[model samples]
Target: MLKIDTVFYNKLLKNFKINIKYAKIKTIHKVIIGRKGKK
Candidate 1:
């Protein structure tokens, strides 16, 4: 049904957003570590 599909779509979108956020954080953390290593 349309409602069920929307629910699923919303959940997928939310998960995708969370993943992007986590990825960004990971990259930032790596950059910080790299900088510390250089020092």
Candidate 2:
């Protein structure tokens, strides 16, 4: 019921946070690679 919903919501939130972190890391890597390619 309510408890289960909270657990599910928490899991989703955690996953969303992890995804955002990974996306940020990926963008940073892309920027570094682009700079390396220029030289």
lDDT of 1 by residue, 1-39 (tens): 999999999999999999999999999999999999999
Poorest stretch of ten by lDDT in candidate 1: 1-10
On TM-score, the leading prediction is: 1
- For each candidate in turn, the TM-score is 0.98, 0.97
Q: List the residue pairs that clash in candidate 1.
A: none
Q: What is the lDDT of residue 35 in candidate 1?
A: 100
Off by over 4 Å in 1: none
Candidate 2: global Cα-lDDT? Answer: 1.00
lDDT of 2 by residue, 1-39 (tens): 999999999999999999999999999999999999999
